[model samples]
Target chain A: MKGLVRTAVLLGVSTLVALDTYSAEPNARDIMEKNFFVSKVKSLKTDSTMVLINDKGQQRERKNTTLLKLQANGIDSKLLVKFSTPADIKGTGFLQVEHSDGEDDLWIYLPALKKSRRLVANNKKDSFVGTDFSYGDISLPKVDQYQHKRQRNEQIDGQDCYVIESIPINETVKTNSGYSKKITWARTDNFLETKVEYYDVSGRLLKTQRITQHRQVEPQPARWVALHREMTNHQTGHQTVLNFDKIEPGVAAPDEVFTTRYVERE
Target chain B: MRLRAAISFAALMGVSGAGQADDSRVPESPAFEGVQAFLQTRRVSGALRADYFHAAKRPDQGSDLLGVTAQIKTLPELGERIDGKLEARITNPALNRDGASQSRLLEGFVTLHLAQADLRIGKQIVAWGRADGINPTDNLTPRDYTVLLPFEDDQRFGTTAIKLDTYLSPQHTLTVFISPFFKPAMISLPTAGRTLRETTPARTLANSELGLKLDKIGEGLDGSISYFHGFSLLPDLRLLGSNPVEPILESHYDRINVLGADFARNFGRFAVRGEAAYVDTRDTAGDDPGIKNPYLFWIIGIDRTFFEEMNVNVQFFQRRVRRYHAPEGIADLQARAVALLNALIDGQRDRISNGISFRVSNKWFNNTLEAEVFAVLNLTRRDRFIRPLLTYAFTDHWKGTVGAEVYGGAADTQFGSLKPRRGVFAELRYGF
Candidate 1:
């Protein structure tokens, strides 16, 4: 009994220290409540083509595309990612991420050989179309899906930031994920999450996601400078870099675009 | 096998022209992974199970045993093609009021895959024939002579066999099998693998033999069909099955020919299935030996999904069976072989058993409350019986079924003894 108490105390103190160290703080939620604005947001759509460079400097390029539409009057958006190029995948719909938590549901669709499938949660760590970027890292995170606790203050690329530790309260929360906990760094000024590291159910580090080149002081008349995300799978040594190409504002698409008819309008 | 062979044939034929239709047509479980990717899961697990059986007649007597099984379902996930189920079962010897409990290592085997073909080594279930009632070609495993009938229970035996299964296409498969003579337990053995003086197991094969089979069929929602022929070693136990030192009589009943076919197709809400098989057994029958019994079986049922949310289902089933005459020479093989069987039967030389069973079930109330009724009627000369049963599935994995059977007919028929067979069974199962 005494040993149990001593162990519990040690765990509690260590957890507090770890949370303080990785907090990305200045507090991501507080920043979320502040700076970031989708004032004139439109349906964001893009064809993110990727090129892989081997150690020997050889390149294998793939035509991967992602589509997202902002929810009118809200910062949330519904997203779908598809890989369609290189002749190998002419019309393969790789994935579709939906937001359906309450009436608000979330989903990801995959079309490889003519059939499409729903990519569900417990899949946060699952590869995205054979890529390293987990489904959760690429898709939008639920507002406070986890209790965000600001741990420490840090600076990345000259931006003031708040490092926060997010822990899922109940097992029922669906992030299409299996993460026990995650440490995220968010810029306090812009409220944009800069970096995140995910841990497995066993509390072992599984992967890392780093967001770069925020629409910071855009020279172009774009609402967001197109956020860049790089996701790496530590176990497989595979990584995928995503670029949001076409960014528009003030266009909250109605239910029409989420339909199968428009998704495959071709 | 038929489906696999068809798949290959279709692939070759289609690629020569266009693309082949695939299993994508069959709604797959979100959990099912494709062949190439499926080969990557390396899973190992252990399980423990207990079975307790109580016979109504034996009030104070019952059978109970606890068993443990360890399975390695995956080989080195590296080769991208190691296949087959390999598991070992160990049951501890225990006291039983009804029967003796014995221990044995159940099964162990490995399967190797090459392209679309599969090769299996070690003891395995060499299941054969599509005939529902009679599977004459399924002989790789030894016959459990004590069962209601030979090969009646799929769990009884796993013989050392080598089989090759090749998929002709996504819809067709073909398999050939051979079981080099493996020893079968001589029931008369005073001890495991032992007799009065010398140990004698009823099995003999001076040479190895091969069997060929071909199947062309399938009806997923409905059923499947096939044609098969195999040389199975039938123990000639005229000697050991008799009194004292029958001196291990062992011989072979070679060159058995079987022509069989079976299928079931669902026309709307009604599902119909049937099997017709003829076995030209190559046993030299003597006067007292039994004849080769061929049979035909047919079943038709209608399952209408009246409600989805409630999962309410109602169905009706009907079955018809026809028995055939045994070969003239069957009555000739070592006389005792026939006498031993005749002693177990109280019927006339010419016998027939025909029956039909029907059941109806309704599932509702959060899938918790369920009601079911079943009835069976025996329709044959010198035989008559009736059985009624009920069942309820209280939960997803727990259910109870109880039934009572009444017999009325002369002692010469299955209705003999008027034993009034009845029992209640409760089972619990959980899946991961």
Candidate 2:
């Protein structure tokens, strides 16, 4: 009778622990898919300021306006960015068109040159116009490009969060992104990424990005936008902070706004 | 002499009209709302610049200038659909020293936005083609080669025209342009003792320039087909008397028609671009030694990025003369030299001449510093030219640029003939 009771207790405890584990850990791909859709609105327009601060406490500021619209099939997007301030770079613009199957198309217009030039999109690791945020950081990579694994659950700034570790799947992704691994901290309820840490090819910490001031821009479908983001490079002791002055989600825009000709307009 | 006067006019009018075309903006601070409000109606901005150049071969052949430029662009107010822009510049120790200070109008244009079309009328620049550094189909706007600017595009000046762009579809556009006046390129040659006179075509309806282009954008490929009918921007030299010591030459414009097509497509991380143009000139028989023969020019290029911020672009170009004739058979050495110079300058020295262009650029220090090198080599004549540039941004409003231009090969070759002009230059600019 004693032996049977002990065996029953062990079996019950094991089953409970297994059930708890199964429910506690979610699929990495599912989390990423939700995170990707969190900010994917029909269209968006925003005016923002980017501040670059160096190690010596010197700061340089740049103002820009961005317009983005979802393309056909609602998976890909096209984006246009125009510089508004910093007299030297004023009137410069960038146009990007995302593709579902292949590489994206990117073009830049320099007011000084009075011409637009198409550029290769492989420079994902390059600095984004002197900002600490790299081109890869500004662009959203496909969810399948990296292999993701669940880490642990923790509370960050009083909000429950889940940590996820992602590693590039191939040499191309690794080289293009210039990152060996990335660790992301996302909110549990909303699937909004709150923070991310990047590791260089040598597995050293390169940069850290912190996102805050999340606001729900759309109601029916539930969309949220981050009002501020700070990206810091650990090795260089440089940081870039982006603050959105005005953000309009689900706005309607004409398709012509994404064209190179329109982006080059004064 | 007429040649000396023509040279002076070209130096004064051509070189003075060269610079950048941009609507600079006043840097805004969020705290200064009052200033920002006033700037919205009429955006006024300007730049102060100082330039210095020195030639290695000839110490006295370079230029030094201090200049200030102002540009004003009016933003639409009260829901108006029209806007205007004007740019002007004043430089000291003008290329023509007849005046202590000289001023030139760079661009003054007004644009009207219609439902499906935009009409622009005034002095404006219309740059065409997808090629880098060299563009064969870009013949509408004339450039001053004598301008002592580091970038070749800076030598371009605005021309008066009426341009209309009609949007046929979201991905297609049709552009039409008409110009009442003719502008010829100012080319500097080694005319030590020659008496040359320039004669521009009369401003008549027949001599007007017209262009039409249909452009397709977006999706996988971007392409365009264009046609131009105008007096050639390049001049043909007519020898009045073939005097070996002091020949009297007359520069005259010829009527020509150009049909051009260009396309660009991206494959993975690499982009491929191709442009071709067939020029039909008056010298159809290819018998006139002083006139240029009909020919075809094409360029194929590929660009890709490696390691992050480094970019490499390589292009191969060819010029094929339809009816070929060699200028070596000319009896007079001076006439032969003149014909040969034209052939070399036009890249039609042979039935088919091939060339290659390479450009590499990289940025470092978070884009604070940038370095670029550009080179072009003629496979047939073995002539080459290389330009290396470095730029540093001191602040958001200040920039410094330093560069060198080098030419190589025999003197009779195209780039080789300009070896004497090879020099290093520097510019300091402050924009506000």
Candidate 3:
């Protein structure tokens, strides 16, 4: 009986030691997975403004309303964006529905033509409505598509963060993203991403993204949302600043708003 | 007296409904609540435009003119399931008219939203088909070809009709349309020593136009199948009589049927769209030289983006006339005139006609500037057309556009006949 008790105590001690080791420093993949899904709320509605500034101090402003909803699977999502200001592009809207099979569907409506057209869904590296943010930059990257490694911890804006380096797993992912590598800075407490640096094929810095402001949207189990973001092209000296005038998380959004018919309406 | 009574009744109902508001809401007088509802549920928007066009060569064929236009649109919501739109336009130096003013209602309609369907009535514009500019299934509305607009779609006008769209499933819809008025396409026909007269079809129950369509809009594909039974928007030329010098031609509408299908699909980075329509005209046997013959028209296009920002679209179109007979060798002068007119209007100069269109567009300067070049080549008839346009946004509310249209080929070809109408144009618009 004494031997049996001694064995159980040893086993308990080893298990606690193992758990402590894991809690001390989580794996990079787990951290990245949390960072990618940090904003995947049940539903989100926001009125956003995007300002583009050139090297010569010229600026342009665009206003839009964005609606986002997570599908039942919790991985796929639907996004709708409608432009309201900037006369030349007023009444233009885009609808994107993500599928589990990686075949997303996109549709664009042009008020001048009074028609909605289906668009090919593979232009991930292209600009998002001519903004400095590429389509790939704004979308959440799949965790399994990259090789992640936990780098040395760092301090950003006087807050502790986990620095992670991610490299594309294959040539297709690399080509589609137009990025060879990405480095992310996520807060240690919430796993909310605060900064990212994109590298081109030749390992040159292409763009830098920074989240300047964020807010806790839910209280029971904390959920955070980025209120202000800025993307700057290091190669072109151009920058785009995005601000959310109003953001409502966990809001109720009807499924009808994601349809092409809704996008075609004035 | 009836209209005034109806207005008063509506106002009374509005005030009565205002009294039933939620108690938690801010308190206000009933009349004030009614006025607030009216103002809060309505949206108003408009644009002012200044345009100029210059014909450098063959000025007699075109014109040099300057014009200004004001477009105003309003949307008013009456209830949870009811809304209406009223769009008005006023222009100086009206289209095809010099030193004239014109005012018209571009679109005015009321829509009723039901559980599974939507019903719209009054004048409205409905665009059909999945193809780019060359749509074989877009025949429900007529166009003004003489409008001095840089974009081809700018010439479209609303048609008075009743339309119903019923949702059959989450991704499928069925549409039905009916119109009692027959509006014809306005084309400038050359009259060199010829007297022409036009007559519209009588507005009768039997003469009403009808259209039906079934559309699927999701699950990786967008497509539709449609059928239309209506009078042809383009009038047919009939030779009434001929004197020694002038030939008298009467233009009349012909009943016709159209069966169409269109689809759009994405394959990797390329989007493919295609449309086909079979038009069955009154000249089924191809025996009548004064009426257009039955024909099949199809178009297939593919678009892709290169270099992240430059988009290129390529399309191939073909038209095939059934039981076609050459109109070149008609012995009688009146018969020849009628045959030529029909052939010209239907683009049936060749039994099998084919063409290609290519467009390249790009944006720069943070999307403040856009440029596009569009070209069409008629391979069978050797006619060609090209348009180049550049648009720049000066500010949030202002924009400027400059473009030029040029046509080339022998006079007998479709686009070639309009060579003299080639010109350069510019426009500035401000929106509020």
Candidate 4:
């Protein structure tokens, strides 16, 4: 009788322990989903300056205006980037429509050509206007497309963070993307990504991105915006610094702003 | 020259006067400060360029050209519908021993914006067609081939017209253009062997040109269909009188109607584009040797990028003449020679002519240095033209470029005939 009672007690404790472990540590996918929604907004407009530094430390600066808006009926978003400086590239524009279900659509307008041309959507690993940021880096990744795992809990810059390892779920995404895997450090308090390390196809560190500045934009949903970012490529010994001069959240952007006609307009 | 100088000075003074007027009229309130700042941001910007060319065989055709251009634009206040733009350019050729310098207004237009439509009226460049390098539907604006510039964009000349664009939806638009002035393309003639004269149509409403286009923009594809009722920019050559050594010809424009369509789409890492046009030269019977026969022109191209930076484009083009025939009637030996020359040069009587064009470009050093190569091969004529160029941005507003144009093939072919004109050129430009 005593052996039977001990077996019941042991089973009860084991069940409770399993439930506790599951509740205390959330899975990687859920954590990433939380991080993705932490700062999502209806619309945003930003004036930014991009500084590119070569291996020799020579620098070039480019200014741009960016607008982003979420679709009303779907999880997709639209983006427009217009270059405003460096006279040779002035009046250049890029428009993108990021779909939730599949690949994104992109178009580029060149002032010299005086026309807007549709660009292949699969070139996500290409540089964005000579900057270190690739097209994929500038766009938000679809959370479900990546397989994620919680690596550990650590502290970076004195803030507690959840270190997560993310790998592409399929060969298609892995082959097209510049990085084989990415390890992200997200703050526990706000779920803001503070740092990320990118690995190449050979599993070598290719780049490191750090967010140095953040500002709270909304109070109700607790939205935070990164005001400054720096990306350094390990293999090329090149760096790109992005400084946001102005950021406006919840701005009203009409659908026309995302159209190719608007991109072609002078 | 004096009148143009006066007009330029007056425009400068007008800008200063407008600035002063805005300063006095704007109030000190914070709300008005935004308006004042926006108005002050509207200013004239321009560029100054110097170009030099050297020909290996023809020193007389080489030239040193200097030019300056200025442009100004202003956006209307909120709730207002009127906006305006003004652009002007002046150029001087130092070595050509032709005429004096020239100045002209490039574009001066006023736009009226409505709820779903906009109308613009003045001298403007209406760029049509979607194909790169070669445009079969780009007939609204006339080009000046006599210009020493190598870029086709620089050779375009605007015409006085009224244009209207109506937004049918977010992805569709309808555009209409009406131009009262008929400006024919100006091609340089050989000064030694030919005496050339031109007869242009009289300025009248009957000579006006009309064009319409329907454009569609979508995620999967983008394209346009257009129709133009206008005169041919290239004139038809007619023999007036001739000697055994020299011939005198009258070049005159002819009425034409064109229907064109173009489309572009992207598939993963590749992009495809196609353009086609059918031209009706009014004389459909192919009986007149002086006038070109009706023809169908088409181009299909693809683009791809490799190695992260290199972009390559290839295109196949063809032209098919309807009711084709060879020239037979000739009254004089010189006239017969001229007719044969025209037939050979125009390639309009050929049953079917095909060609291929390819271009590759790459950039380095944060896009400061760019190199490009472009080639066009005439398969039917066994001729080819190649151009290679390198450009460097020295500063934020300064640029330098060096390039060479090369031609090769049979002596009677188009590119082969211009073999003597092949040369190297350099240019420097500063913008503000």
Number of the top candidate by TM-score?
2
How much lDDT does candidate 1 score? 0.43
Judging by DockQ against the true structure, name the best candidate. Answer: 2
Q: Looking at candidate 1, what is the lDDT of residue B205?
A: 58
For every model in order, what is the iRMS?
A: 20.4, 4.6, 8.1, 7.3
Candidate 3 chain B, run of 10 with poorest lDDT: B16-25
Specify the CAPRI tier of model 4. acceptable
- DockQ of every predicted complex: 0.01, 0.43, 0.34, 0.32
lDDT of 3 by residue, B1-432 (tens): 334433443453343243223121235478955753454345666777776665422223345556668887777787999988888888763343354677778789999988778899988887888988888888888877766556677678788999999888758889999999878877877666788899888999898999999999877899999999998888888888987889988888899899999999998889899999999998999888778889999999999987667899999999999989888878997678677767777788889999999999999866768999999999998999999999876655566788998999988788888788787777767665
Model 2: CA > 4 A from native: A1-25, B1-41, B56-79, B93-100, B242-245
Give me the overall lDDT of model 2: 0.78
Candidate 1 vs candidate 3, DockQ winner: 3
> Sorted by lDDT, highest first, which candidate order results?
3, 2, 4, 1
What is candidate 3's lDDT per residue for A66-177, written digit by digit as tens? 8998889888788989987655566799998888676788889997787889987777787888788988777776888889999978988877889999999998778778
In candidate 4, what are the lDDT values of residues B234-336, reduced to their tens digit?
Answer: 8777778866777788788888899999988887778888899999997699767677789999999998887667889999999898887655456656666
The digit string of per-residue lDDT tens for model 2 on B1-432 reads 334433543343333232221112333455654654466435655566555455422223333332223333343322377876677666542333242454656677888878688898888888888887778788787876655545676667778889999988877989998998888886775566777788999999888899999988777788899999987887777677846679887778888899998888877678898899999999999988777889999999998887767889999999999788888878888788778877766777888989999999998767768899999999999999999999876666566778998999898787888788776766666655
Pairs that collide, model 3: none
Least lDDT summed over 10 consecutive residues: which range in candidate 4 chain B? Answer: B18-27
Per-residue lDDT value at A31 in model 4:
80
